[model samples]
Target chain A: MTERFERELMRGSLDLMVLSVLADGANYGYLIQKRVRDAGGDMIKLQAGTLYPLLHRLEADGVIKSKWDHSTGRKRKWYELTPAGRRRIRDQALQWDKYAACIQRILTPALAALPAK
Target chain B: MTERFERELMRGSLDLMVLSVLADGANYGYLIQKRVRDAGGDMIKLQAGTLYPLLHRLEADGVIKSKWDHSTGRKRKWYELTPAGRRRIRDQALQWDKYAACIQRILTPALAALPAK
Candidate 1:
């Protein structure tokens, strides 16, 4: 699939996905991107344009908090989910699961009805 | 999950899912909604506010076409996938598969890393 298409699919759920990663522990921007890529099997990567704006929005909305960490001898903005963010992630994850299951149900039968290749 | 949340998750994929359902056979709005709900295990339902606009938009885009069917002694707008809609469904289904696989990969590891409940 084209990167654009994958990105589009990722658009709506990006916030929840990011929060999910952060739920494990706090992470810096680059590391967050790396984790997502590693988990996506290298097929999905976040673009700076999409990532930064979302981070900013999440921070502004009080869903996430950021602080500069210089413990590694380099300054990086580290992000973690807030209480609200954690709640949001839970709700979003549950919602995603239900949504996916519903869509799968709708598609499976229709797909089965297709003529065999 | 709230209907709103499910709808949000459905936003990006609504068009493609609808096309996929239509790809199976021509259907009217209520039936289309029924098919989706039945397949979604009744957990996911489409609102008229969302569904009608999407249908209009797809029709305008020439991805789908609608005609009035009076066979049941009632006038119902039946929608069928156009050739473009069919092709779009193929592309979208492939994209959804790849995107889902990628997200699953990322989420699985992060989720596994979380402390046991």
Candidate 2:
């Protein structure tokens, strides 16, 4: 809204989105970026600078595991969720729902109470 | 959720929530705290330490204005929206809706594709 996407608002959510991308199947960095962009439309864009560090952190946290594949002509590091990551997606998704509902509870009435334009 | 409130998620939102509180009418620190807490149910709690600084920043930004009132036998600083604040509420509320919807767009299908519990 402020000429830039609200990156601060997106901070806590990046992990969950990345995990969700892997939920369907393994993906390298670029494809995960594409899935989020496609799903989010203009609202989300995962720049490579932001995405790689996040992937490293998730892998370091043991939620994801990676393996390099050279069977195809091009080499790629593909990531998949660990069992723990599956549990996290389930947990974080529930938490995201609760947080969204909390904001709505305050926001809906606040919008209604606003003065006419 | 974590044992603690997701303060990271609350970071960018505190400004909007404080402005929304002032949308109804002027309110002093304690009343604003009560209103946000009640509206957010168990999900939000605005401690004085966090609330006061945010109020001062909003005042500095010129989106909100404050007055010291002594009519009720005790001095209290009451805050209300400025004309700019009204515009901010409208704009921020719309942005918030867009952001929420974006998350839902990605999250709903992600949830559906997850393995059954």
True contacts kept of each: 0.48, 0.53
Q: Mind giving the per-residue lDDT tens digits that candidate 1 earns over B6-102?
A: 5556756777778878878899888887776677665557777778888999999898999988888878999998777767776777677776766
User: Alpha carbon lDDT of residue A41, candidate 1?
Assistant: 66
* Candidate 2, superposed: residue stretches over 4 Å from native: A1-5, A72-74, B1-5, B71-74
lDDT of 1 at A18: 86
> lDDT at B19 for candidate 2?
83
Q: Which candidate is the best by DockQ?
A: 2
lDDT agreement of model 2 with the native: 0.82
lDDT of 1 by residue, A15-34 (tens): 77788789889987888877
Candidate 1 overall lDDT versus native: 0.74
